[model samples]
Target chain A: MRIVRTVADLRAALAGARAGRIGFVPTMGALHEGHLSLLRAARAENETIVLSIFVNPTQFDEAADLTAYPRTEDRDVELAASAGVDVVFAPDASEMYPAGFATTVSVSGRIAETLEGAHRGRAHFDGVATVVVKLLLAVLPDTAYFGAKDAQQVVVVRRAVADLGIAAKIAVRPTSRDDDGLARSSRNARLSPDERRRAAAIPRALGAIRDAAAAGETDAAALRARGLDVLAGAGIDPEYLAVVDPDTLEPMQVVDRRALVAVAARAGPTRLIDNVEIDPETGR
Target chain B: MRIVRTVADLRAALAGARAGRIGFVPTMGALHEGHLSLLRAARAENETIVLSIFVNPTQFDEAADLTAYPRTEDRDVELAASAGVDVVFAPDASEMYPAGFATTVSVSGRIAETLEGAHRGRAHFDGVATVVVKLLLAVLPDTAYFGAKDAQQVVVVRRAVADLGIAAKIAVRPTSRDDDGLARSSRNARLSPDERRRAAAIPRALGAIRDAAAAGETDAAALRARGLDVLAGAGIDPEYLAVVDPDTLEPMQVVDRRALVAVAARAGPTRLIDNVEIDPETGR
Candidate 1:
């Protein structure tokens, strides 16, 4: 496997492989099972797999959160190699955004401005959107893999790609989970043993809403209460417990169609989010 | 040349040409000497040339201006073919922006929000930046040609391309002009015979600034006054006449280095803008 740090080197590395399919997985450098899953998917689908490990500073609303974000470069490189990544693009902040860089890619309206946008600030998605555009352009991947854990981010990215006519296809894989049903996240590693157990409540809370919605509880208020009950039992008060349309992220009073039950809360010093999609018709 | 109205068709058209260098020139339809000059430069350097004629609605601040914007498709195709364009990607509004289009590409700071941005509103550059991104992605050209007539726009495009890590190299061709020293523009067709004569003074005013700067004039106010005097002689009251940094578009109090004297005014019912770049050392 080859590791290239500059955009020019990345392009040069992929120059001869243009005729074949290129699959990409973009992530911050803490290689967990979730990230490896994306890399594994990319490995199976394409002639070349490119993994980008850049902790995009723009996406972080708080400097402390950014500083605290994990950076396991050596471990990540080993994991990427094992996952069959042909090339790893690890660019520093200055290399990715030189001096005088000022462009922003934004997806406006509810898809981007609600839920996570509300909690993280609008700059969160704008940062995500901008960095994604840069990564997609740099990689020119035929298909890019994204986990369903960041559901709103997936929606925002899909909107930005379609609206801007980006050539790559976005493939959303199911959210990776732990044996305890906790959704896998790099931040999960930062949790202490007690915090890890508490983090499990987030997914359990979402699971309660999913189970309720599947059992024909269509009223959003009632569904939200069920999820809140689960969180309350674990002594957790969520930042938000929303029953929203899966696509638009707009709150739905009645879940007549597909809906997403998402929850966010602090587990010790780490902030984590988890979600599950529920359909009124099929319940699963 | 082959004309592809859909992005899919455009990609299909350019698929085989990817092995060779592709140059792109994006413009709004009513072709003129300015657009053709860009095409000619593209023809000389690239193995294949793609020309896009899209009068993007998002850029227009006034509905009346958008309505009055001339579109001569048949003539444009002929002019493109004569200028050696290989493929013309002419997408309709619906093709470029389908119903749910919501992404905007913006270059923040004075580079985008001042001068033309100030007069036309921020949405104008947002629109320009957005459509240009869509077009560039659609073409995936090695180099994209932009006319230097829209100087600030060139700066915006260059900034957007760099910030986004877009692979295309931006080439700015010199502003094409007429025998009367008027900058060639698609909007020039809207000028009446009397309005056309009055429009000539716009360029003359800029020329005065350029000439004065060459003769060691450094004070921006004096340079602006010299240009304004030329407009006054023609009985035209400009909407804006200021000296600004060529790259940043920030108002300059003194012209110590390269400066741009830009002016905008109404020629009868038509709004026109013209500018000339000046260097204190070698102002020609």
Candidate 2:
């Protein structure tokens, strides 16, 4: 795998591959099984697979969280090489946000205000959408890979691409999880053993909601009650437990079609989020 | 000029021309001399010139203004063809904003909160930035053109392109004006013949401010007073007359380097905007 640190170098490298199809997977380093899974899908689907690992500072509302977020650059490069990655774009903050930089991409309305967006600071989705656009343009990918772990993010990104007339197809892979049922995340490495055990409740709550939907519980308040009970029983206090339409993300009183049951909880000092998409029409 | 009404058709036409450089000039289709001047610049600068005439509704704060906005499609096509435009993208509102459209581009800060942005209501610059981005991505232009008459728009678009990491290089031309010194605009066609005579004061006021700055008058308030006096002398009640740094658009008390003297006023029923860029250091 060839590693490039600057945008110019990446573009130069990509210039030759313009005629071929490219699959891009953008990450914030500390690659886990989840990120590897995306790389695998990208590798299988396209002639060229480009992975970018830049822990964008603008996305993080908390300074300490940003500073403390794991880097693990050497390991990340090793993983990408082992995963058969073609090119890796690892841009620094200075490279990503140069001097006099003042452009931002924000996706607002009913879709952006629910679930993870509600508890997280206001500009989180804006940062994600902005950086995603920058990366997509730099890579010029035919298809962009994303994990269903960030289900809401998939919606936000899709909306941005359509709204901005950005040309790229979005492919979502199933959320990766550990044997203990906790979603795979870079922040998961920061959890203490007990905190890790408690974090599993996040997935457990989503699972219960999904199962309840599968078992004919269509009311949102009832679904929220079931999910919140699972979290509380496991001593994981949730920031929000919501049942919303998968696309618009507007909270639904009755699940008429496909919907998402998602949760965000603070397990010790770390915040964890997990969600599952459900199709009420199929009762799953 | 090949007229394409849909984004898909435009993309298909642009695919074969991908090897060549594109110069994009996005306009609201009234076919005034100012827009034609942009077409001339685009024609001269790049291998292919793509012009988009979309009067985005999201930018208008008032409904009547949108209803009354001039749209001279046939004349616009004729003017563009005569100016040597290769393609004209005249998408209707439905073509530009399809169903389930929920994406917006906003550039906020000191630059977006002054003059036209302040009085025109919020979401004006946001709309321009958003639609401009949509057009840029659709055509994938190497260089994009803008008129300096809407001086703040240049700053906003420049900031948006840079911030979003868009590849287009922004190229600005001098504002096109009529023989009477009134800036050429689609809205100008709405004015009565008498109003057109009085509208000359808008640019005349700007010219006076430019003259004062060249004469080494460093105080901003004095420059504004001189500009407003010119407008009042012609029966034009000004909405705002201010001296600002051209880039940041922030109100300045003292002219430091290059500054902008801009004004917006109601000449009878039509509102007009005009400005002049000044280098106070050299008193230009």
Candidate 3:
């Protein structure tokens, strides 16, 4: 595996592999099993696997969060290589954005106006859409892998690609989770020992709500209350817990159709989020 | 030259070409000498040349402008073939932009805020940047040619390509002008014979100011007044005549640095615009 730090260098490497099927997985460094899962999936599908590790500053709303985000360049390269990534591109912000950079990509409504969009500050998704467009253009991959852990992000990216006529197949990988049912996240490492232990309840709370919704508990308000109560019982500061349509991302009064039971909470200094689907027919 | 309308057809035709070099010229139909000059330049520089005549509706602010825009597809194909163009793509709006399109590209501040940018209505350049990006991606040309007659348009496009990190060399062809000094434009056809004759003076006025600047005229206000007065003397409704920095597009008060002597006017019912550079030291 080659560790490339410049867009030009990465392009040079990709040029030779143009005829081969390429799969891209873009990530901020501090790779965990979740990111490695995306890479391994890309490796399985594409003849040429390219992973980019750039901690995009534009996506972070809080300065302290941006500064505190983990960086593990050396370990990330080794992990990606072991996961069968063909190339690891680790570009600095300056390389991605030189002087006189002025262009931005934005979507007006719906996709950028709910759930995470509401919580994430202004221009957050604009930055995401712009950087993703840039990376997709640079890589020119046949398929790109993104985990469903960031569910809203996947929807926004898919919408951007489709609306803008960008040619790429986006494969949304299932969210990777730890043995305790906690979602595998880079931020998971930031959780203290007690916080990690308590984080298991986050997913467990979402599971209970999904079970209730499947059992014909059609009241959205009740479902939200139950989920929030679970997080509160776990001594977590519940940010938001809601029942929403999975595809459209609109709030739902009941699980009459496909719905997502999503939750977000602050467990100590680490903010954790998790979700589960409610199967209306199965009542599971 | 083969006229390809669909993206698939264009891709196939481009793929079949020899792997020497490819030059592309994207234009709105009703080709004049200026567009032909670009085609000629492309033919001279590359082993294969592809031209796209897409009068993108998204770029037009006025319905009348779009309606009045010429559509001479058959003649355009013949002219392109004569100019040795390998392929000509003339896609309908539906073929390029389908329903449910939501993404847009916007450049901030100066480049998107001057001359044509200020004159054209909202989302015009967004449409241009988006469509241009799409075309550049689809054609994958080694070199792309654009005329400098639309000076601000050139800067906006150049900034977009650089900001998006698109890997294509952009060549700005010098503006084509008539003997009487009117710049060549498809809209010039909208003018009556007398209006067209009067339009010639638009460029003539700028040339006189350029000559004055060459003779060591330093005050930008004086240069602008001279250009505007010349146009007014010709009975043209001089919209604006100014000496300004070429790159920044900011109004200049002194001609110690590089400047552009540009003019826009209403010749009867038709609007005509023209410009010339003032290089104080070289005295062109």
Candidate 4:
């Protein structure tokens, strides 16, 4: 696979492939099962597959978190190559945001202003939207792959892409998870042995909400309480356990049709989030 | 020229032209000599020319101004055809911004927060940046043309295009002017006969500053005072008379190199703006 480090270089590499279908996967460097899943999905679909590894600094709400975020470039490139990635774009912060970079792409309203937005502050999504737009423009892919692990992020990006009329399709694959149901994430590497065990409660809590919703519990507050109980029993206090509309991310009072139950919590020094979509008629 | 009203149709029309150079000119209807000049420039250089006429409502800070803005589609189509435009994309507000649209493209820092930004509020530039991004993406032109009459706007749009990594070159044509040296603008039609005559003072004010700079006057404050004197002589009170860096839009204490002298004033009920770039060594 060819690895490029500049936007101009990335564009030049993709110029010849414009006539063919191009599938893109944008990720932060430390590749996990979730990222690999996206790459594999992209590989199966397009004539050219481009993988971008940029741990965008603007998206990090805390400096400590940004510093702690892993950067295993060599391993990431190997995994991307294994997944049949044709090109790997690894640009530094300076290349992505050079001197006098002052533009921001933002998606306002509930999709952006709640859940992650409430906890991480608006800058998080603004940063994500900005970098994603830049990457999409840089790649001009026919379709971009994203894992559903960052569910809220998928919604925000979809909103930004649609609102801006970006000519790229966003395809989301299901979240990749471990045997114990802990969502696979690069941050999972930071979890301690005991903390890792406790992190399983997050998925369990989401599962509980799904089970209850499937069994005809329509009240959103009741569904939230059921999940809160599961987390509390596992000795984990969630930052937020919300029952919301899958699209708008607005808090839903009743799960009349479909609802998303999402949870975020601190496991030792690491923060982890998990979510699941549930239907009242049937549980998947 | 064939006029298309939707983004899908616009894209379909320009799909075959992707092999050749596409030059785009984005404007608010009621075409004048200034817009015609940009079209002419595009005609001379590009194989296909796309003109978009959208009076974006989001860019207007005041409802009255938006209501008062001109919309002459028949005349605009005739003028665009005369100027050799191949296709005209004229999407209405609803077409451009359908239901649940929530994205905003903004340029921060001095370039976006001062002068016109301060007078019209930050929403003005935010709206402009957002719509311009949408329009640029829709046309995907090889080069986009803009007039230098709206100097600060040119700066803002340039900043946004560069920051976003948009795949288009911004070509700025010199400001088109009337026989009386007044910058040609669609808004000029709203001016009364007396106000139309008074509007010429705006350009004269910029000329005074340019002339003073050419004569080795380096002090920005002194240069601004010269422009103010000219405006005062015409019995006009300017909203702002600024000598600033052409790129950053920051007030320049000393014009050691390149500087932009810009002025905005009320000519009766109509508000008009004018600017001129000056170099101390050899000012045009």
Q: What is residue B55's positional error in candidate 3, in angstroms?
A: 1.8
- Using TM-score as the measure, which candidate wins? 4
Per-residue lDDT over B1-284 for candidate 1, one digit per residue giving the tens place of the 0 to 100 score: 89999999999999899989999999998999899889989999999999999999999999999999998999999999999999999999999989988899998999888888988999999999999989999999999999888888999998998889888999998888899999999999999999999999999999888888888889999988998899998889999997988887889998998888788899998998888888877757
lDDT of 3 at A142: 94
Model 2 chain A weakest lDDT span, ten residues long? A113-122
Rate residue A68 of model 3 by lDDT: 84
**lDDT, candidate 1, at B61:** 98
The TM-score of chain B in candidate 1 is: 0.98
Docking class of 3: medium
Better of 2 and 3 by TM-score: 2
Residue A27 displacement in candidate 2 (angstroms) = 0.7
Q: Model 1, range A1-284, lDDT digits (tens) per residue?
A: 99999999999999999989999999988988998889889888999999999999999998989999989999999999989999999999999889999999999999988988999999999999999999999999999999999999999999999988888999999999999999999888889999888788888888888888878888999989988888888888888989888888889999999888888899877899889999878869
Q: What residue pairs are clashing in model 4?
A: none
lDDT of each: 0.91, 0.87, 0.83, 0.92
Best by DockQ: 4
Q: Each candidate: RMSD to true structure?
A: 1.5, 2.1, 2.3, 1.1
Q: Give residue B141's error in model 4 in angstroms.
A: 0.4
Using all chains and alpha carbons, the TM-scores for the candidates as numbered come to 0.97, 0.95, 0.93, 0.98
Tens digits of per-residue lDDT for model 4 on B18-114? 9899999999989999999899999999999999999999999889889999999999999999899999999988999999999999999999999
Report how far off residue A109 is in candidate 4 (Å): 0.7
Q: List the residue pairs that clash in candidate 3.
A: A214-A283
- Considering the two chains of model 1, state its CAPRI-style docking category: high
Lowest-sum lDDT 10-residue window in model 1 chain B: B275-284
Q: Write the per-residue lDDT of candidate 3 for residues B154-262, one digit (tens) a residue.
A: 7778888888888888998999987766788999889888887778778777877888888888888787777777777777767677676887778888888788776
Write one digit per residue (lDDT tens) for candidate 2, span A1-284.
Answer: 78999888998888888788999999999999999999999999888889999999988878888988999999999999999999999999999888777777888776676776777766888898889998998888999999998998999999999888889999999999999999999999899998888788888888888899899988889988988898888797788887877877888899878988877888888877888888978877
